[model samples]
Target: MSINLSEPIKIVFNEIEIDDYLPSIKFKIDINIKQFTHLLTYSGEIWIDCKVWDRFSKGLNEGKDTTLNDMDDIFIIEIIKNNEFIEFTWSIKRKDPEGNVMTAGYSSKITDDVYSVIRNEFINYPKWW
Candidate 1:
């Protein structure tokens, strides 16, 4: 396969999930390149506020499901290319038990830049479409 260096790269958070009942949710984030041929995946435990999880789970139980569907869900996934390697971040948000907000994100030379682009694309894509 041929690779295009001039192509604007975009990383997409294909899916994200938080396990219920765990004091710290064991979450998994799935990522993929928009136009390239790479699949990035991350899994780890994130500390989340019990109240927040309860509320979210409650909503899900009430039929207010908000599962991520690749075609319709909007995520921040812009590639930041560097000489060493790709650096990116994820848009996952978690509220610590102390009410502090933390993002389920990562970045490094070995990782792809996952920070969202908040330019025209942000306005064009709704949270849920």
Candidate 2:
């Protein structure tokens, strides 16, 4: 039997809403991962302070590992550089109707180009308030 490696993680920024009373932006995030012929997807809405994005970018530029999460802890993304590859991890947490917390996540290692992909996405993200 042969082992299969997962595809590079994909992140898409959907609709965005800037809070009028706060320095935060609320937006929808869509994450997709494909392994062989199987596709896994997760989408959720999260609010994040405007400054966090800037800080995240700076950290990446400095070659430091970084982790970003929504204000509510509902979604989280962690990126770490390992030699010539980047380790990407994402997780989602939610509560069932019975109030029990459920969590799911996935991690993969992809080419260092992932850093450029993320930077481009953030730079071109919707900015209308």
Candidate 3:
């Protein structure tokens, strides 16, 4: 489904599983922006102590640029605030046939509400330690 730029961007973490003995989490990030929707399944460990989400939240609150990537560098998200709009970029890297590395990304200018929603999503993410 397509999301309007005026509306808050959607970010959801699903299929969450925490490691029993490690401070790591495994989940899929389902993100929707404008007309693009992607479900990124992260097979690599996401360390809780990294505080990536917290950094994103702080950056959003302070109107600064923030870039976050999975441990394996499979998924990357970048957010930059410009004037009254927020520039958001989401990219994925994968190896194509013949071991060729390829990257695909989508970018859009969104409203402040989108930034707030994303910031809260990170700030309130459950910490299941």
Q: Give the best candidate by TM-score.
A: 2
lDDT of 3 at 79: 91
* Cα misplacement distance, residue 18 of candidate 2 (Å): 0.3
The residue pairs that clash in candidate 3, if any, are none
**Tens-digit lDDT track of model 3 for 25-57:** 565565554554544332222333345656665
Q: Quote the RMSD, in angstroms, for model 2.
A: 6.7
In lDDT terms, how accurate is model 3?
0.61
Model 3, stretches more than 4 Å misplaced? 1-11, 20-22, 31-49, 96-98
Which residue ranges in model 1 land beyond 4 Å of their true spot? Answer: 1-36, 65-90, 93-129
Best by lDDT: 2
The global C-alpha lDDT for each of the candidates, from Candidate 1 onward, is 0.34, 0.69, 0.61
Cα lDDT tens digits, model 1, 97-124, are 7998655443333332222222222223
* Candidates by lDDT, descending order: 2, 3, 1
Q: For candidate 1, what is the lDDT? A: 0.34
- Candidate 2, 2-32: lDDT as tens digits: 1112236666655557776767777677777
